[model samples]
Target: MSADILTFRPAPLSQADAARRRAMLLHPSNFVPASAPDRDATEKAEEQAGRFDALYKEFLDRGLSANGARTEVARAAAREIWDGFAVQLRQHRAAGQQMDANVLAVALASIQCLNSVLPRRPEDPHHAVRAVSTARRRLQYNGGLLHRLHPHRNPAFQDAVATLQSLEVFLTRPQQHAA
Candidate 1:
C-alpha cells in the first residue's frame, strides 16, 4: 500500500507562558484524581501530609536548640502547613460529596504524617507531650470518622485504629514538665 506522508505541526509556547502553564498544572489547587471527590481530597490530603512530614523532620532534626530566628521561622512554617490543611478540609466538606478514596488517602497520609512527627518523650518531654496530644486529636478526627463508616465493609479501619492507639500512647506517657 502506498501512503502519503504528512508533516505534523506543533504549537509553541513562549518560555514565560510555558513556565506559568507548568506551575498552574502542578499547583495543588488544580490537582485532580482519577476518582471524584476522593481524587481531589486525596491529593489535598497527601500534600498536607507531606508538609506535616517536613515539619516533623525539622523538629526532630533541629530541636529548639536552633537560634531564636530559626525557631520562629520553623514555627511559622508549621503554622502555615496546618492552616493549609484545615482550609482544604473545609473546602472538601463544603463541596458536599460523599467521602471516597481521595478522602481516605488524605486521612491515611495524615495519620502517617502525625505519627512521624510524634517526638520521643525523654528528650524534649514538654513539646513531645504537646505534639502527641495534638496528633492524637487529629488522628481521632481523621481515623474515627473514617472508621465509623461501614465498619464491616473495610478492614483497613483496623490500621487506622492502631494508628490512633499509637498516637494515644504518645499523648498519655508520663512526663514531669520542666519548672
Candidate 2:
C-alpha cells in the first residue's frame, strides 16, 4: 500500500497587499525594524534633549530655584528656536518664496515662548514694548502674505495678531502708570 502525502504553499500577495506591506515595513513605528531617517531623527531629538538637560543642570548649580531654572532653560530654548526661525525667514526671502506654513508655525511658537517667559510687568518696559512691536509688525506683514497664499490659516494668524496686541498693551501699562 502506498501512503498519501500533501504539501502546503502560500498564495502570492496582490499588488495592493504588497504595497501595503512595504508601507508598513517602512513606517517608523513598525516593530520589525527602524528606518535610517527615523533613527537619525530620533538621535537628533535625543541630542537636543540632552543639551536642554545640561542647561537646566547648570542653572540649578547656579543656585536658581527649580521653577526659576526651568524658566531660564525655556527662555534659552525659545531664543534658539527664534534664531533658527529668523535664519529660515532670511533664506525664504532670498529665494523670493512666500513663507510657508512651517515657517509661520515656528514664528508662532517663538512668539508664544517669548510671551511665556516675559514678566507681566518688565523692569524695562520700553525695551519689552519695542521687541513686542517689532515681532507684531513682522508677523502681521508675513501673515498678510500667508493669508493670500494660504487662506485657511487666517484664524491662526489672526489669533497671533490679537495676542501681540494684548501683550503690547500689557507691556505699555507700566509706562503709563509711571508718567
Structure candidate 1, residue pairs in collision: 38-102, 42-102
Model 1 spans > 4 angstroms off: 1-100, 112-122, 144-153, 174-179
Worst 10 residues of 1 by lDDT: 170-179
Best by the lDDT measure: 2
Question: How does each model score on lDDT?
Answer: 0.43, 0.53
Clashes of each: 2, 0
lDDT for model 2 comes to: 0.53
What's model 1's TM-score? 0.28
lDDT of candidate 2 at residue 152, scale 0 to 100: 43
**Per the 3 Å backbone cut-off, how many clashing residue pairs does candidate 1 have?**
2
Which candidate achieves the best TM-score against the true structure? 2
